[model samples]
Target: MNVLVTVTEGATVDDEFRIDGLAIDDGSLTTDLNEWDEYALETAVRLAEADLVDEVVTVTIGPEDCEGTIRQVLAKGADRAIRVWDDALERSEMLDVGAKTALLAAVVETEEPDLVLTGVQSADEGFMATGVSLAAAVDYGWAAVVNALEVDPDERIARVRRELEGGVEERTEVDLPAVLTIQTGINEPRYASLRGIRMAQRKELAVRSLADLGLEASAVESRLRLRELAEPESESEARVLEGSSEEAAAELATVLREQGVGR
Candidate 1:
């Protein structure tokens, strides 16, 4: 099986604030693989190790600086990594979710992997809508927030487990050539072994640009608009009360009632 893992170079809330000039400190921001995407990468690597998959290919779209995150995935066990280089994209000019999805769709079409996986959402934007959009663009079935995956390549089916409200799990089976957005806690990501790191250094990384994918700036859509960025209001300090068991219970009930709990 050939598995494709799509990753994004994202900024944290703090990083975004700093880039937008809302923060005073000019400290350089730290970047790492998105947490949810780490789960995706781990899933792909596990599948490959179990003989369920033959190769694992990781892809991402960002400036050259994104190679750090891509290299981290390669170090973890990805067979190869592809970086889509576009510096203008980092300036928030072509930052629309739909545009990004379209670019990814084009790349996936060229690669033609059996399974495509990604994080449920980027930590910074949290649009939480890219997976479905990319699937639609590529004309593939998509399952989101999948906590578990059981692939039966012989049967060409994948049984997926998703988390629902109220601590419930939803199960569904999707056919091959499907896209899945992995949820957190699906599995623990393993660190890169020395041998794996050395092997990754010899792997090939293919870079593509917007024009190479037959995309133009005018072809993208911006369904959402960003007006202004602001900091969240600081939370008030907590207050604690000490008393007898009964008094404490009563005080807790009073507080809950005042806060409109169970109203």
Candidate 2:
């Protein structure tokens, strides 16, 4: 019962990060293992420690520089790490779900893990589609925003409690060889120990090229094209109508009416 977790590179905007008109300078970007995926990986590690799973492996797709991110997960207790990258992939926008799903699909087929776990969304793009796309590409049943999971290896069934709208939860059972996109707060992720960090640097991290995965440059076409990027608007300022209660209430009603708002 091998469990595979997919990790993505999360990036932070540095002080030097700025937009030159519509084009952002990504050279100032600093990358790390995604926070949400860390939770997913932690869930996998707990399952392995409980003897519910035999092994835990992590996979990611990015440029050679991404090895560091993979090692970070290894330090957290993943048995093996696989990084898939190529010049073509580096030149392309990998945040597109199609290319990402294809890369993960290749890895899934090669590894043949019984269960796959992923974060609900990546930190950088936060598109929230990669996990679902991966499940579809692999033709595996999937549960999204999973907060609680219980696996019965003997029955090959997994009971999952997923978060829903209005502070509600939905419970369902998924067969083995399925996917689970974990939400944050599912568990507290463990920090990498000093010894584990040192060992991770020495661990042999496997690099898989597109060719090694039987994929071509054309095969991983990014179906999504990005347009202009912009920052979100700040929240509207709070207004304090100064005066007595009746005065403030009258002022508020007048202000609302002026703003085309009705009570």
TM-score, model 2 to reference? 0.85
* Least well predicted 10-residue stretch by lDDT in candidate 1: 17-26
RMSD of 2: 5.7
TM-score of each: 0.84, 0.85
Report lDDT per candidate: 0.82, 0.87
Candidate with maximal TM-score: 2
Clashing pairs in 1: none
For model 2, residues 1-263, the per-residue Cα lDDT tens digits are: 99999998888778756765545677867788998999999999999999999989899887777787888898988988898888888776444888888889999999998889999998778888888889889998888899999998999888999999999999999998889999999999999999989888877678899999999888788877766677667586988798999999999999989999984
lDDT per residue (tens digit) for residues 67-167 in model 1: 87787788899999888765445555436778778778888888898899999888867878888788889988889999999999999888999888899
Best by lDDT: 2
